[model samples]
Target: MKALKHLNKYFFQYKWYLILGTLFTFISNLFGVVPAQIVRYALDLVKETISLYFLYDGFGAQTVVYEIFAFSILLYGSLILIMALLKGIFLFFVRQTLIVMSRHIEYDLKNEIYHHYQTLPLSFYRKNNTGDLMARISEDVGKVRMYVGPSLMYGLNLISVFILVVGYMLSVNAKLTWYVLLPVPFLSGSIYFVNTIIIRKSEEIQANLSKISTFVQEAFSGIRVLKAFVQEEPSTVAFTKQSNIYREKSLDLVKVDSLFTPLVSILAGLSSVLVVYIGGQEVMAGRLTPGSITEFIMYVYMLTWPMIALGWTTSQIQRAAASQQRINEFLNIKTDIVSTKDISQPIEGAIDINHVRFVYPDSGIEALHDFSMHVKAGESVAILGTTGSGKSTVANLLCRMYDTTEGQIKVDGFELKEWNVQSLRGQIGYVPQDVFLFSDSIKNNVRFGSLDMSDEQVIQATKDADLYNNIMDFPEQFDTVLGERGVTLSGGQKQRLSIARAIAKSPKILILDDCLSAVDTKTEHQILNNLQEIMKGRTSVVISHRVSSAKLADKIIMLDGGHVIEQGTHEELMAKEGAYKELFEKQLQTEETNS
Candidate 1:
């Protein structure tokens, strides 16, 4: 019930529909209970011994019993027919209004969760899996809808029937009504006791289902790796174990449901037996007539449905409570990266990192410690470092993927936090080491950064990245559809495609973080030559391990252990006979030996 509080706003938004649905429910139940009273009157009229005093005096003197019976049949028969028709009509409206409202709410909730997912920080994604989140959005949302629609409607219907039927029975005979209702309190207590267990088991079942979803997702995504390592058997075995766990949890929930329904049925049966016995004794004592006993029995039969419905409705409510709690947990997560202040002006690409330090949330060691650099506007600086030397960390910081833990980062003289995140990111073009492309055409992939990019612009970006010739060789060229994650392309083609995407953005600052590691040296040199022209009058940061990639920059910085070890022009560094010169000589000797 506490978990359902999140939906209060939506309920209020569409309160009119809910109110109408409740009204229809009440009217439908009102008409539904009228047939029992009609049956009572018909029984009294057809009795073998009729009291003339109870009938109209003129009709009693003028008409025979056969004439009275025929008259009663025509009048009561028409009334019952009309009541049934009205009940059916109101029931239709009740279903239409409340059920459709639930679907509308489901649509809104799905969109809200998806929008929230987009705004969450990258760290949040790192902590949660795709399949688990999908379960929250799809399965959990559906369970919540059950409570809003059928559970609520049926619960209200049960209450209406209880009140109307009980009032009618009490009017006829209060003492017999009390005796027949003896089992109700015990039945309600039983349902309450069973509901606690059902709620706990339902939560466990949903969690295990999520685990199975995650297992299937991960298995399919990494199927190629499993086959390559010849570990398919082990993966299958693991999947079977997870499936078994899901089955066991589901069976446990079924067991609780099995117990609840039968318990409710048995209690209802006891009430019916009590009604027959007590009412019979009253009829024999001359306190109640036969027709009155018959009417009381019919009312008890009507009450049976509400009791059974109580069990089913309670089960739905408990299950929905468990699911709503899961969904609310996700919706309540506060986004860590949100703009607190507005920046009106666009950014210029002069980046300054002033003694910044950053540590990943899950790792205790710092990835970047006391690292500082400055690149003026229109300056092209190359970074050279071994693996784990904070080269990529610098690019991440400039892109604002993660904020600095210690110091300040500024673009165009504005602090990273001072500028709007989207505006700041729009000016920078970053090509990461691991490129990711959608399953779309080459042209669409290149133009993804700017939806309004022209075909000519896309072609130009591909040519600049040295990918135009490769794309032209395909049958459909730019219209060719790619496989998942661009798996149809070779490694070098994928890297160049990534470059083309960044180039198509035409950003003010371009950061290439070891994006050319797969291409041959000849192709790499040609691409760099082209980038020299494109990078003119634009700030650029190139991170690479190869000297050939860094030699074209106006300046080069070498890093080790998250600290700058050297910064100079290529000729100046070579003349100084330092680490850069040593690496250059080593690479030259290797090339000579291979030749």
Candidate 2:
């Protein structure tokens, strides 16, 4: 209930829908009472007319009176039919107002969650799996819709129909009405006793479902790896084990859920028996007329659907409450990476990393230790390090993906955090180690960073990245649609396309973090040569392990285990007896050996 309280705003938003739906509910129930009243009146009329004919010994009045009675019955039967038809029409309008409003709320909730997902930091995604996130937005929200739509409609129907029909029953004969409603307290108690267990079971089912979804998502996403390792049989066994757990959880819930309908039906059956026995006694005692007894029976039957439906409505509400709690858990997580400053500032590309120390929040890994670097506007610096030496962390910092744990970083003499986050990221073009491409046309992929890029600009960016020739060989060229994650291209081609995407943005600062690892030295050298012209008058940081990629930089820094081991120009580093010189000689030997 605490979690479901989150939906109160939506209820207020669609207040008119609820109000109108309530109005229709009352009107429909009123029509139900009218038909029952008409039946009662017709039955009493027949009884009275037949009795009078018998008292007079059918003195030729019998034939004429019988004919009139039949005519009156037919006319009353038509009125009952008209009332039923009107009730159905009002019921349709009830669905239109309430159910349709639920859909609008669903649309709004989905958009709200998706927009929040976009604003969440990368760290948030790290702590949560994609499958769980997807489930909350899709499955969880769907359950909430059940509560707002069908559950709400049926609940109102139960309330309005019960009130109107029971009130009429009291008017006809209060004693019989009390006997018929004897089941109400027991029903209420049964629902109360079952509520706690239902909620607990629903929560377990939803959680187990999330785990199953995550397992399937991972299996499908990594199917290629499973086949490559020849572990398909093992994967299948693991999946079967997980599915068995889900099945058990579901069956436990179904065991409890299966009780609701039968329980409600049993109570309703008891009500019918009471109407037959007690109402007959009342009629014999002259407390209730035969017509009144018939009306009481008819009203009890009228209440049956709303009574039987009450259990289903209660179950859906419990499930929805459970699911809504899951959704709110994620929605309440506050992101720590939002911008503190609201002002935008121009970046001249001068950067200073003054004794910065940083650790990854999710894994608690110290990626950078006392790292310090200085780059003037238009200068190019290459960070040379082995894997896990924090070369890529520097790129992440410059892009403001994560702030430093200990020290301050500044761009153009302003603290990184002081500048608007969007403004800061927009000015930096970063090509990370893991290249990702959407399943879109080649031209659109290249134009991803800057959507307004002309075709000529897109072609030139690809050319600079040394991928224009490869794209031109394709049937559709720029318009060629890529498969999932750009599977249509080779590894090197994908890397080049990612590079093209970055450079197309024309940022004030450019950072390439080992993006050329897939390409051969020849292609790497060709692309770097083209980048030399592009890097002019803009701050550039090239992070790589290859000496060939660093030789042309204005400055070079070598790192080891999150610490800077050496720093100098390529010429100066080669002049010294240090790790940088040793690495350069070894790389040069490898090239020579390959040649």
Candidate 3:
């Protein structure tokens, strides 16, 4: 009931269409039963007219009987033709209204789910799988549509037809009506029992399908790695195992349906046999006429569909309910990262991290401990650290990707929580270590950080990142569509493109986190020189392991574990003969050895 309530807005929004469709369904079913009553009347007329002709035994009596029979036949034929035409017309409109309404609602729900996904925090994405989410939006939403459209339409039609047919049957013979409806209770019980199994099986099937989707999505995303490591066969085996589980779950659902459908048909068949046997005996006993028995049988036949439809509609509702629950779970997630609704103030480049502590949710390990730093407006600071030393964690905290567990992070005297999240992120340019480029043209990828950036700005950023010549050498140049994740470009080229994207944003604060690792030393040095002039007035945090990258910063901080071990200017840190100096000497020796 709660799941159904979630869909009420959509239902009410299109109530007019639903009401019209239901009205047409009622009219169509009404016309459908009229033909059966007409047949009964025609039969009774023929029997009475023949009896009168036998009694009179004259030419006049015979002529009257012939005229009555001819009129009755014409009336029945006309009623059949008119009723069939009306039923067809109304049924078409019923489908058009109800089915189309379901499609519209489906479209709305899909968009709503997608919009909800966009609002969710990065933590929510880490906890959920892309494949599972995709299955909910696609397959689960489809199941819900089945309940809204065809299932609702057929269920309503069954109830309307059942009521009219049963009322007419009772009118003809009350005793026979009781006997004909004996199997209904059993059928209802069977539907209730089977629906439980169907619901359980449906959930399992949906879960397994999500597994298959997850496996396929991961496999395709890492196809390059699989081929490079010669692990394609192993990946195929894993996918096959997941596929088999999906197939087995689907077959379990099919087995339940197979058993339930036949049981429903058998019960309907029993009702028909009971009506025929009992009504035939009543006819012979002179208590009921042949026409009444014929009408009773026709009503029993009409009841067959509603009984069969009971089982089908129950299954559809159960499956839809299971799917709705999954979708509701996703929609109900509370995003941990949200900004003050009323605040839209822009941030300045000044950053202050005061006694901050942070831990990753999944790992339960502290990424930063009592970490504190202050960057004056327009200052360039470099973070130098080894792997697992919290270099990237600092950058993430600064961007509010994950909020600090303790203390405060302020930008230009305002706390991080006080600023609108989108507004805060907009002012910062962040280039991650693992660069991700969309499968789009080079120009579009570079312009992604700031969609409204001009072409001249994009070209200048590319030149600054040392990627302009590489782009122009291509046939289509900026218009050339990149393969998935810019696979066509070299590692260095991809890294430079990521840098160009960030530069085009014209951000007040820029954080480049090991973004130049793929490029050679000479190329890295050239790019850094170009960026030096650009970073003059902007607050910049350059995070890297290489000493060359840190040496260019006005101030450098060296971290070990989750704590900062040293902080000073490049010359001051080198002169101290500490961790910074040791790293610098090692890199210089490696360069000399390579030369």
Candidate 4:
């Protein structure tokens, strides 16, 4: 009942269409009832008498009999015609209404789920699969649409028809009505039991299907790796296992459904047979007329469809209920990160982290411990660390993608929480380790970073990122379409393009997270030099393992195990004989050996 309440908003919006459709269905069923009544009347009018009313008795009943039969035929024909017309009109409108309603529901549900995903942190996606999430948004939502459209209307129609038929049957023969209803409780109870099993099996099947989809999605995405490693057989085995599980669950669902309808039909049939036995005896004993018995049988037959429809509706509702629960679970998740409703005044790039402690929510492993740092406006600082040393965490905290567990972060002397998260992020340009590009023209990808920028501005950013020559080399130049995720470009080209995107933002602060790893040292140096001039008076945080990259910064911060170990200029660090000096000397020896 609680789950059904969710549908009220949509139902009320289209209530008028549903009301008209119901009215037409009722009228159609009423006309459908006429044939049985007409049969009973015609039997009473002519089953006896006959012989052309004993060869024209004048006013002795021949005229009366013929007229009664003629009127019955004419009345039933007209009702049938009207019913057919109404059915067609109602059906068309009902279909259109359901389609329109389902479309809106699908759109809104998908958008809500998608927006939730955006607010969720990177860790959430890292722990879940691409295929599983895709199935929930696509397949699960599709089931809800099916429920809203056809199942809802058909279920309602079934109830209305059942009520009309049952009432008419009781009026015809009260004894026969009791006989028919004897089996209803049993049949309905059995259907309810089967429905429970169906819901459980359907959920299992959907879960397995998600796993199978994930396997296929991952296999195709990493096809190159599988080929390189020559692990096709192993991959095939894993895929087959997932497929088999999905198949097994699906078959379990089918087995239950197969038994459900047959059992329901048998119970309904038993009731019909019992009704005929009792009503036949009544007619033989003259307690009820033959014409009345005929009408009762017709009503019994009419009852069968509604019975079957009831069972089907039960199954559909059960499946939809399960789907709704899963969808609701996703929609209810609360994001740990949310900006204040009201933003403070904008900043001019001074950032201070005061005694911050932070951890990934799910893992509870601290990524930063009592970390404190400060950067005045226009200061360029380099962060150096080995893997798992919190270099990226520092950048993420500054952007407020994840909130600190303990301590205050301030921008331009204002608390980070006081500023709108989006506005603060807008001021910081970021180039991540993995570069992502949409399947669009190169010009469009660059323009994405600054939608309202002029063409000259775009060209200048591309030149500064050292990607202008690469874009011009293609036949279509800046207008060339990149394949999915910019697959058409080499590693270095993709990295340079990402840098171009960041540069186009004209940010007050730039954070590059090993974004230049793919570019050669000479090109890296040239781009860094160009960036230094452009980034003047704009705070920057450059993260890298390369000493050459660190050389470009005004000061360097070295970290080890989520804690800062040293902070100084390159010359000062080399003179200090610490971790920085050791790493730089090792790199120098490697370069000399290569030379």
Say which candidate scores most in TM-score: 2
Please report, in order, the local distance difference test score of every candidate based on alpha carbons: 0.86, 0.89, 0.88, 0.80
Candidate 2 residue spans exceeding 4 A from truth: 55-60
Structural similarity to truth (TM-score) of each candidate: 0.92, 0.96, 0.95, 0.92
Which lDDT tens digits does candidate 2 get at residues 1-595?
7889999999999999999999998998898789888988999998898887677673787777778888999999999999999999998999999999999989988888899888788778889998899889999999999999999999999999888898888788888889899998998998888888989988888887788789888888777788899988988898899889879887887777778778878888898899989989988898877888788878888888887788788889999999999989988987776666755977788989999999999999999999999999889999999999999888888888888999889888888888888888888888989989999999999999888989899999999999999998999999999988888999999999999999998989999999889998899999989999999989999999998999658999999988988998988888887999898889999989987
TM-score, cand. 3: 0.95
Model 1, residue pairs in steric clash: none
Where does candidate 3 have its weakest 10-residue lDDT segment?
Answer: 339-348
- Cα deviation of 424 in candidate 1 (Å)? 1.5
Instruction: Give the alpha carbon lDDT tens digit for every residue of 282-362 in model 4.
Output: 888888777877887777777777777776667777777777777676667777666665474546888798988888876
Q: Is candidate 1 or candidate 3 better by TM-score?
A: 3
- Ordered from best to worst lDDT, the candidate numbers read 2, 3, 1, 4
The reply for model 4, stretches above 4 Å from the true place, is 1-8, 12-28, 46-75, 284-289, 592-595
TM-score of 4: 0.92
Judge candidate 4 at residue 481 and give its lDDT: 96
Question: Model 2, residue 77: displacement in angstroms?
Answer: 1.0
Give the per-residue lDDT digits (tens) of candidate 3, residues 1-595: 4676789999999999899989989999998999888888888887887888777786686887777778878978998999999999999999999999999999999999999998887677888899999999999999999999999999989989988888888888888989988988888787788888999998888888888888888889989898999999999899889888888888888888887668867877787788789988998888788788788778877877776777777788888999999999989987778775536665568989999888888668888888888999999899999999999998888888888889899898888887888888888999999899999999999999888889999999999999999999999999989999889899999999999999898899999999999999889999999999889889999999998998568899888888989999988987999999999999999989987
Each prediction's Cα RMSD? 3.1, 1.7, 2.0, 2.7
Best by lDDT: 2
Candidate 2 local accuracy as lDDT?
0.89
